[model samples]
Target: MNLTVARLTVRGLLGRRRGILLLVVPALLLVISVIGRSSGSDKHDLAVTILGELSLGTLVPILGLIVGTGVIATEIDDGSIVYLLAKPLPRWKIITTKLAIAVVTTWAFAAVPTLLAGLILYGTQDGLAVGFALGTVVAGAAYSAVFLLLGVVTRHAVVAGLGYALVWESLVGNYVQGAKTLSVQQWGLSVAKAVAADGAIPAHVSLAAAVPLLVVVTVAATAFASVKLAGLTLASDE
Candidate 1:
C-alpha cells in the first residue's frame, strides 16, 4: 500500500458527504436496534431480523457501495485519476491502497455498529453479538472489494451496486433458495451461524461454501480491479 495514495483516498472518501452517510447509516441501525430491544418482541427473533436483514443485508451493502465507490469513483469520474496514474506507481498498488481504505472504512461504519447493535439487542447470550459482528466484518470486506471493482470498471458503480444489494441479495436471495448460494449476505450469515449457538442463527449457505466463495470473490475482484485500473484512460470532459 502506498502511503500517499492511501492518504489521498482516505481524504477523498471521508472528507465529504459520503462521510455523513457513513455516520448516519450506522447510527440508524443502532437506533432501531435499541427500539427493537425495548419493543417487547421476542429477543432472539428480533435480533435475527435486525442483524441479519437490516445490518448485514442493508447497512453493510449500502456503506460498501458508498465507501467502495467513493474512494476512487469520484477521482475517476472527475478525470483527476489521470494525475495519480501518471505517477511512477504501479497501478495495482493504487488499486490495493484504495481498496484497503474502503475495507477499513466499511468495517468502522458497518462492522462496529453491527457488533454494538447485536449486543444491544441480544447481549452475549448464545454468542450472538460476537457471531454477527464477525459476520459483518467479513461481509463488509467482501462488499468493499466487489464494489471497488465496480467503481473501477463502470461509471454507474452505485446503481449497479444498489441493484445487486437490493435486488439480488435482499430480494432474490431471500425468496429464492438457489440464489442464497451466490449471496454475500448469506455467506456472512453462515459465519454467524457457525459462531452463534446452533439454531440461534439460520444461514442457508454452509460455512464451507461461504468461506471459499468469500475468499474467491474478494481476491478476484481486487485482482480484476487492478487490471482495469492499469489500463484506465482519462474520462473525456465532453
Candidate 2:
C-alpha cells in the first residue's frame, strides 16, 4: 500500500464537511441509548431496538456510505483523481490504501459508538455490548469495501449505497427471509449472536454462513475496485 496515497486519503476524509457530518449519527446513537437506559423498560427490548435497529441498522450503513464514497468520490468529482492516477503507483495499491483508510475510519465512527451505545443501554448484560460492537465493526469493514467499490464504479455511489442499505437490507431483508441470507447486517448479526449470551440476540443467518460470506464480499469488492481503477480513463470535464 502506498503511504502517500494513504496519507492523502486520510487528509481528504477528515478535512471536509463530511467529516463534521460523520459525527452526527454516532452522537445520535449515544443520545438515544441514554434515553433508553432511563426508560426502565425491558433491557433486552431496549438493547434490540437501540443497538440492533438504530445502531447497526441505521448508523453503520450511513457512515459507511459517507466515508466510503467520500474517500474517492470527491476527488473523482473534481477531476483531481487524474493526478493520482497519473502516477506510476499500482492501481491496486491506491485502492488498498484508500480502502484501509475507509475501513479504519468507519470502524472508529461506527463500531466504537455502537459499543458505547450498547453499554449505555444494556451495561454488558448478556455480553450484548461486546457482541453488538463486534457485529458493527465487521459490518462496517464490509460496508467500507463495498461502498468504496461503488465510489470507483458509479458517480451515484451514495444513492446506490443507501438503496442497498435501507431498501434492500432494512426493508426487504425484514420482509423476505431469504434476503437476510445476503445481508451484511444480518451476517454481522450472526456474529453478534454467537458472541453474546445465548438468546440475547436473534440472528437469521448462521455464523458459519456469515463469516465466509463477509470475507468473500470484502475481498471481491476490493479486488474489483482495483481492477476497475487500473482501467480508469479520465476525460476532460470540458
Cα lDDT listed for each candidate:
0.92, 0.90
Using TM-score, give the best candidate's number.
1
Per-residue lDDT tens digits for candidate 1, residues 161-189, read 99999999999988999999999999999
Q: Which ten residues in a row are the worst by lDDT in model 2?
A: 229-238
| lDDT (Cα, tens digit) per residue for candidate 2, span 49-87 | 788889888898899999999999889888899999888
Clash count per candidate: 0, 0
Off by over 4 Å in 2: 233-238
Strongest candidate by lDDT: 1
TM-score of 1: 0.97
- Clashing pairs in model 1, backbone N/Cα/C closer than 3 A: none
Could you tell me which 10 consecutive residues in candidate 1 have the lowest summed lDDT? 229-238
